[model samples]
Target: MGPRFQNNDRARLYREIYEQHGPIAPVVLPGDVPCWLVLGYRELHQITSDPVLFSRDSQLWNRWPEIPADWPLLPMVGKQPSILYTVGERHQRRAALISDALAAVDPFELRSHSERFADRLIDELCGRGSGDLISEYAKVLPALVLAQLYGFSDEAGARLVPSINALVDGGPDALAGRDTVKSAMSTLLASRRAAPAAGVASRLLYHDYARDFSFEEILEDMMVNIVAGHQPTADWIGNSLRLMLTDDRFAASLSGGRHSVAEAMNEVLWEDTPTQNIAGRWTTRDTQLAGRHIAAGDLLMLSFAAANGDPQVRPDRGSFTGGNSAFLSFGHGEHRCPYPAQDIAEGIARTGIEVLLDRLPDVDLAVSPQALVWRPSPFLRGLASLPVRFTPTPKSTAGGSR
Candidate 1:
């Protein structure tokens, strides 16, 4: 029997699945379709790295072509070549170039931008005394960061963030959000192509992969970076902050010098990563992995959340390190996330948390931790709204400027 992934009680659900399913186990998802969920840290590591046996090209997925129009799984599994769907040479070439483009980003500049944006946002909220951190701060801040990376105007971030959020929700909103993203990306990239800017998107358009990528291809890549980076970054920010507030030991670890902010971020990435599962890895042929039987064209998913929490993984950050380390929150091999490295992303989040803690000395959850609601989704783990109460303070003279 397969495990039902309960939205509200994810920790318990993941533990039960691991205890029962071993590392690689069979399960039927919400759509009544069967799939193998890779649960163990070592098991997922092997599968995610083995490209010959497990293909990412969704065209190999048997049920996708005729999936019901109303299927909830579409948002997570739908074909998008920008990063998640490509396999083999395509995946390798595209990922390398995107990585190179992101490598050019100045970490100091990114951190400064995040801090300035945080201060500006807090300036607007300090007088109010309370606000929904998820909507007001966490979500918008990441999108704005992404907007800067893509060289998008301030106006574009406002439009893209909500549309991207809606896009991930699936169904009718997904369609609208998809169009909104496509329109925004197309306009943004088209301008870059016409008169290139000194940024990630413009650099990508001139990279090696762009030789084979059409205008549509370039746009898809742009959309994936902005969409991928923002949501998970937002989730990371929210989840990490939640840990600081709810887990007294964790909070103590951060405040009492047991763990630095960087170490705390690593702990969150291992313990409660924003991305719970990455779907749509199809088996190339009948095979057995980690002593499990599989058939050709069988669907598989990597349970990063489950694996990081596996008994095998050490929870301690060990000297506050980051990088490709043992944590699979960023996935591994050919299909990893194509954005800034762990250190850069963490730098942005660090600045954000630092600003919030500095500006609002006593900010805290507005409700009990257990009462917090996680949105129902197959791929993402996010709080629906993070209502936070803070001491009222005078707004900065900076006003509401970006």
Candidate 2:
């Protein structure tokens, strides 16, 4: 067999490919899955937004044994004919229901909850002086929020983060281990059957849509919310912290300036979005993308990092300031990330980081920069551990009594 799926330096690889091949290149995955990687801004939009030529449904590759029948995995969760994977009319309806939940949530209430969670997490993290920011703070905050938003209990929320992490960090072994995670998810779903939280799951479980969705379908949808929304959301916060701490100018813009923390995050996200690559499809019969022919059935891989940094679309921008349009860190078109309204996800993230900055504004790295380990995952873009010593700030009354 060819070498096992080794973790390649994707940052360097992305830059080189874009420079050399000019965005779209035919490459074979280890499993011999042939697809084209789209590295330019325009092509990514064309391929991801298209539903006809490209399919989000894993069922398209059902005959390909190397790819699981669950090939599309978490993205395919909550799949009614109306689910995201479903096309045309069905896709639209399911997307609408999901969108309604996002629209229905009170931004103020969401921000408040996010702030409280961040404060609690920071308090715990501050005590350490140094810890794996990802595990200690970053992972818990967003996962818990997503869990609450998706109608799981506080206890269930606490546990679900690990289950979600296992899937992302554990690779093929963990993907194959979904049965274990599914068991816990089932109990939570069933409990919600009786005592559902007032959130997305409850809305979908009892909505007019409920008539068609089975328990498994609902559980799958819950999985999507947990994995897609929570993991990356939290990762971005942790990653942003690392960036601010390392890059002096970027760091100063956050710590010393009048720039809104949201603007700082937009800069970090422009410089570094969590999603490195995404696999997607074309909607029409055939198309030319980045000067390459794309037939229906051709899969498209989008490099968010490359596109975000593309010299053409990305303006000659400096540090994020007000009245600026940053890169598409949340994505573009119909499937853009629906969080951070007036800073929703960033509201949560900034709450935590602001507290950290205030507490230890002039912290120093505990170890050499090169010694820090980056999270070894393809999708997530962040460090695994961020060790820094800082001068702790005075405890705030809003921060719950320790």
Task: TM-score each candidate.
Answer: 0.90, 0.82
**Per-residue CA lDDT of candidate 1, range 1-402, in tens?**
122454545656777777787778898876677889888888788787888888887777876665787676766777765666877787777788788888888886787678777887788799999998888888888778778777887677767878887776564687888898889888878899899997788988998777877787778877777777778888888877787778664565333333445566776787678888888589889998878888888889888888877755644423333433467888887787644655566666777776777777778889998787777666777777888998899976633232
Q: For candidate 1, which ten residues in a row score worst on lDDT?
A: 315-324
RMSD of each: 3.4, 4.3
Query: Judged by lDDT against the true structure, how good is candidate 1?
Result: 0.76
Q: State how far residue 20 of model 1 sits from its true place (Å).
A: 2.4
Worst 10 residues of 2 by lDDT: 1-10
Candidate 1 TM-score versus the reference: 0.90
Off by over 4 Å in 2: 1-12, 61-84, 171-181, 195-197, 252-260, 282-286, 315-323, 339-343, 392-402
Candidate 2 residue-wise lDDT, 1-402, digit = tens: 111111225545666777888878787654466777777877777656665556676455422445644444333221333244656666555566666665666766666667666676667756556656678778788877766666666777776667677776656656644565677777766876788677766676666666566777667755655566766777678777776767665566445553555565766676667777765553344667778887655556667777776656754535343445556667765556554322456666776677556556676677776676766554567667777776655445674322
Stretches of candidate 1 off by over 4 Å are: 1-8, 64-66, 250-259, 312-325, 339-341, 397-402
Q: Which candidate ranks first by TM-score, i.e. highest?
A: 1
